[model samples]
Target: MVKHLIDEQINLNLLTPEKTLFTGEVSMVVIPAEEGELGVLPKHAPFATTLRAGEVKIYHNDNVSDVFTISGGFAEIVNNKCEIVADGILL
Candidate 1:
């Protein structure tokens, strides 16, 4: 089976206790970690971090595709996937 470009991207999911905010395949994601802004890409090393209240930036094709305002959260990165469980999201 041949893999396409989109299929090779990172899978991102942003969620809150009430609902899931976003879910898609993106090229890159910039998360607001407690330490600092952390950037995650395809094949990124597996890790997890706590997030502070800040903006979460999502990128596709090297451009800003979407942005979300999160009020603190936790992020987990594994197997080319990023799952974020936010305390709250300002929609």
Candidate 2:
């Protein structure tokens, strides 16, 4: 089991070929995983997966959310950090 610290946030990096879209710590991230939707929090087990075409929801401070749409991409989760490389990101 992953022992997560309270008040700790997950390190998130959203990147596109053109540039890095976002970089910061978030309370959680809801991603459109290939198999299904996936929710990630701090200290999540390491995993690599393909992202589906849909909206990526990033949750931070209570009630705060950032939404982004992407066609497809890849995501890696490890050591409480998630890095996303999207094929296309809709602003």
Candidate 3:
């Protein structure tokens, strides 16, 4: 069970051409995609994916949470970190 568990920290960065909109650490992330929603956790497999215009849910420590609407963008998950480069972002 311990070996199967991914017990690493995760950070998310939501950015646009103008500036970075949101940046924080979280336990999980849910992104809207063309096919369906994708969930990511710590130490997840490296991936580069397209994100659809929808809500991006972030689950932080202490049960805190935040949601943002992204028009469209790309998401990359690697080395326990997730970075999102989007065109439009609204919180």
Candidate 4:
């Protein structure tokens, strides 16, 4: 199906070994990478990175939608989809 520019979204999945924390569509996400905070938007290039202990911010409709605190983890982005495998989640 064809999608309009304004309707574009990225599938975000935040998960831990025990359970899934968040799974939905979002406009953007900010992750704490090894280097620093990394902002991920729709159509972002595919890559993987190790996350630092920090907050994961999910954005939608130009506003912050959800936030997750992780002790550390791994994140991967591919084809407008982002998945985070957290080692430990605080909330």
Q: Against the hidden reference, what TM-scores do the models get?
A: 0.89, 0.88, 0.82, 0.90
Ranking by TM-score: 4, 1, 2, 3
Residue 61 of model 4 has an lDDT of 63
Per residue, candidate 2 scores C-alpha lDDT tens digits across 31-79 of 9999999988888899999998998888775544788899899999988
Model 2 TM-score (2 dp): 0.88
Deviation in Å, model 3, residue 2 alpha carbon? 12
Of candidates 4 and 3, the better by TM-score = 4
Q: Report lDDT (Cα) of residue 88, candidate 1.
A: 98
Off by over 4 Å in 3: 1-8, 61-64
Q: Tell me which of candidates 1 and 3 scores higher on lDDT.
A: 1
Clashes of each: 0, 0, 0, 0
Best by TM-score: 4
TM-score of candidate 3 on Cα atoms, chains taken together: 0.82
What would the per-residue lDDT of candidate 1 be over residues 1-91, giving only the tens digit for each residue?
A: 1234434689999999999889999888899999999988888899999999999999886678889999998999999999999999876
* Cα TM-score of candidate 1: 0.89
TM-score pick, better of 1 and 2: 1
